[model samples]
Target: MKPTTSEMEILQVLWEKKSCSVREVHESLNKKDVGYTTTLKLMQIMLEKGLVVRDSSSRSHIYTANITEEQTQTSFLDKMIDTVYHGSTSRLVMQALGHSNTSKEELAAIREYLETLEKS
Candidate 1:
């Protein structure tokens, strides 16, 4: 299941923290004006969706992401490549590189990765 924007935000926090209580998730998302209850509800919904798992042994109910960061990134990238880029990964890379303010170090890393891909 694709996670909503709110759920993604919560998942990012969970991924970073590895495990977190609702309050910790809320605090991580403090930049947004979302309420504690709203975060709680979203987490509960995510649990139901199998995006997250909760440890109910404690009173705080710590949550962890059921999916890995790499998994989520690959899923979204595959969908975007198929849909938005019309199944062209080169087009997606070209568009991304063209538009973004990619640093010299970043570009070098990308080049190195491309070289590795070519060798394989």
Candidate 2:
């Protein structure tokens, strides 16, 4: 399932921490002023969506993201390219570069990646 923005925030926490309790996730997201129960409910929903796995053997059930960050980002990028750019990867790249401040090093890295892709 594609995670909502709130769920994505929780997923980010899980990816960084590897595993955490609801309380830990709530604490880590202190900047948002979200209630503990709200965080808990979101996690529960994520569990139902198969976005996360919970270990309930312990007192504080630990949760970890079922999906990898790379996998999620690739899905998001693919959907964005298809929906927003009409399946044109070049259009997506052009728009992305046009909006951002592209550095020489970043360009060099992109070039290197393209070279690697060509080799593959």
Give the top-scoring candidate (lDDT): 2
- Candidates in order, TM-scores: namely 0.95, 0.96
- Note the residue pairs that clash in candidate 1: none
> Candidate 1's error at 55, in angstroms?
0.6
Against the true structure, candidate 1 reaches a TM-score of 0.95
- CA RMSD per model (angstroms): 1.1, 1.0
lDDT of 1 at 88: 100
lDDT at 29, model 2: 86
Q: Which runs in model 2 stand beyond 4 Å of their true positions?
A: none
How would you encode candidate 1's per-residue C-alpha lDDT over 1-111 as one tens digit per residue?
888888899999999999999999999998666789999999999999999999999878999999999999999999999999899999999999999999999999999
| Shift of residue 109 alpha carbon in model 1, Å | 0.9
Candidate 2 per-residue lDDT, tens place, 3-110, comes to 999999999999999999999999998856678999999999999999999999999999999999999999999999999999999999988999999999999999
lDDT, candidates in the order shown: 0.93, 0.95
